[model samples]
Target chain A: MKPTPTPDFDKNHPDRAAANLATHAHALFAIASEHIDSDTLRRLRAARSDALSAPRRRNLLPVLVPAGALAAAVLALAVVWHPLHAPSTAPATAGTGAMLVSADSSEVDMAQNLDFYDWLATQPQPASAASAQ
Target chain B: MNLAAVPQHSEGLVAARAPELPVTLETFLAQVQRRAFRVAEMGLGNVDDALDAVQDAMLRLHQHYRQHPAQEWSPLFWGILRRRITDLQRRRKVRSIVVGWLGSVGDDGEGGPVWEPADPLADPAREIAGRAAYADLARAVRALPRRQREAFMLRVLEGLDVADTARAMGCSDGSVKTHLSRAMEALRHKLEDWK
Candidate 1:
């Protein structure tokens, strides 16, 4: 319910110019408020009280915020770790994987290039290494 | 400041230490709530909606900004309540638009508005007339456009200074003055007999 602006309230605002309609408007609003029935005011007050107490019923900012942050952090960790901390692949690359599985570190001759191996295969069996060492 | 940078405000909003609000807060709310409801009703034209707006504003002030200095509460609460009233007005406008579109249109358009003067019996050349003059005044206030009505209520009725009203309205000081002036003119023309 609206209240009629009381004479005291109007008088209290001495700073306001007397010529303005604020005083009259205040007075009118005060009258309007006075006309409101009691039951309506009670309902409004009840609503206000309920709102004041709503945080206890469900304050999302407390629990939901931390929970949401934790969930997001877990999601981000999954994304980062999936790429960086994954288990070492069996062989990593196609060529490396095939050769590494079939061969060993000792079998992989360091100086033996694949191009040299092809050229040697094309030659006449290296001429028995020139008939002697 | 970007609000996302700090989540601590949530603590202030949710866990409002009742002690933080000064003793004036309760008295201030109790005193202002009725007038706020009336002002809201003038803007909304619906008692139920006006009640909700006032209650919401009270809760908002109590929960979020009650910790602010008591002196600043009037303008702050009025500003917040004004915004709430405008929000409801916008929602009602949207609903009305939808309904108007669905419903059939008429050429006379409800046969125009009725702007009758205040009931003569309610007035007798006093500093203030009885209930009828006030009723006429309220009717005229309601007849003004949304901005004009808000300006009248906030700047004049609420006694908020131009700057405070502007802050509440989220407008420039110049705009507030303009609205107030226009509202005064409109109200004076309609409510000339009251004066």
Candidate 2:
């Protein structure tokens, strides 16, 4: 294509020069765009077809993200709360003396021996007992 | 304000509310693809990259905004193309930087492949001149700041109105005018010899 003739504009006039430039540049660009090689045009056509046929990205991220975050928070809370509030297998020592019931027989014997000691203390010492000690 | 009392304004509101005539997405893409490719080419300075950017823009528009009003497709498509071009340009910049740092000779950093126009003119001399002119213009355009290049291409070459150009560039109308003015001034100086 013949390049568009540069318009007759005063070279010193900025406005006219700009107008001529816009016109000339636009013409050139239009020619270039319209006369794209057949190979490139074919590629462009194929690209368009591919774009149309390509599956739309099902952006589930927007919906899934918040839900996933929420689920994670709930799971973490469950994890934390379970250990804190779970029923204990060990005996409760807060209000009941039931803990002593589960103790070894030796501990029970020790408790019984405490009563014998108390009785021994209560027995007043005789004058003979005192001299023998 | 009693909206019903303003008949003209009410009519305009009703018109605005009226559903736009349906234009198929395929038709819209076809209509803008060539011009979009040109715009991308101008911005990217490489034909293949330009084509890639255009295709990417088309796919994104189809994927995300197919349900939008047809009247809005022009700005939306152009906006997508503009962003895609920016991304490609940025990638090229980073690649050039990496290539330079690595001391690789593969990329000369001298503006990747040049586009050779397929001129069918019987007069070889005229064809050469035409190609030279186009090359000169493209070079000057590529030299522009990113915003100015976008404004010039969208406003002048692609012939988008100020509003649509602003939308495509993600700027205000006044900003578009400012960018376009600066671009023109720059081009005027660079292309003075052509005039």
Candidate 3:
């Protein structure tokens, strides 16, 4: 017949078991520490430094950086494209006429352009009058 | 001076004015390198990986010592070494995120941890015997699962308390407890068999 496991070695005995194990475990660690040498330690430090620094030591920024910059540039262009390319709010016909009026502000030029101004002044009255009545 | 000469002179000036730091980088390595290596070896099983991990941690320590206080180096070294070991465990496929999560959720709350402080100098004979026992324990510890081994070495061998071990291992106190408990169980079974 197979031997039945002892119930006495249950949770209650964990403390005693742990203590005994620790005692032996501690001894094992000391012996291992003794086998280790200064040179081995020095070598480990060197290897650790190399491994930790591997992620940062690089020269790929030039190749990788431009792609990110191009993406950002594209995104920026997309955001501003609509605002920049949208047509002006001014009445399309008024823009060229206003540019012409502003270009020559001399008394003689204004006197010559009085008809254009008069026509512009007359254009807005119809919209305002329609709104009022 | 010519533009080239001016640039050269500035470089020379910066080099001349550089701090004669009390702890030279090489000297610092010489000071803490071995202990750090031993800590790494004990914390992470597999001497080869431990060596690599310790070297990596030492390099980081050397690279950053100027930014940190000298006294804080030990804990910082441990913190970094633990990170390296975790990375190694990940690469070796010995530990999975699922296992770590399960271990964390299973910790028993004893209101405090079970590992206690014992006097090292008070009992020389006992200390010697304990040291021998620790050697065997270290091998058993190395055989444990990565998380359990980490918790065991950090809390027990490195003499770090639970909170410190938790910080080093990047896990909860509960997780540390669970790992430690499992580690203790494995050690007991293995040691009993060996004796």
The top-ranked prediction according to DockQ is 2
TM-score order of candidates, top first: 2, 1, 3
Where model 1 places Cα greater than 4 Å from the true spot, the runs are A1-20, A56-133, B1-24, B105-129
Any runs in candidate 2 off by more than 4 Å, and if so which?
A1-14, A61-133, B1-22, B104-129
lDDT of 3 at B146: 81
Error of 1 at A36 (Å): 2.9
Which residue pairs show backbone clashes in model 2? Answer: none
**Candidate 1 chain A weakest lDDT stretch, 10 residues:** A1-10
lDDT of 1 by residue, B1-195 (tens): 111212232222211213233466676787677778778777776767788899888888877776778867777899889889889888777776765654546565663323222232232113333455555666788889888788778866666666778888889877777776677667767865544
The residue-by-residue lDDT of candidate 3 on A1-133, one tens digit each, is: 3322211222245465564344334334433454455566456656645644554443467988999999999999999896677667645656656667657567648766779999898875677778899
Off by over 4 Å in 3: A1-17, A38-133, B1-32, B42-47, B64-66, B69-72, B93-135, B193-195
iRMSD values, candidates in order: 15.1, 14.0, 19.2
Candidate 1, residues A85-127, lDDT tens digits: the string is 6657633555665676678666566323657877778987467
Better of 2 and 3 by lDDT: 2
Order the candidates by lDDT, highest first — what do you get?
Answer: 2, 1, 3
lDDT of 3 at B172: 86
| Alpha-carbon lDDT of model 1 | 0.64
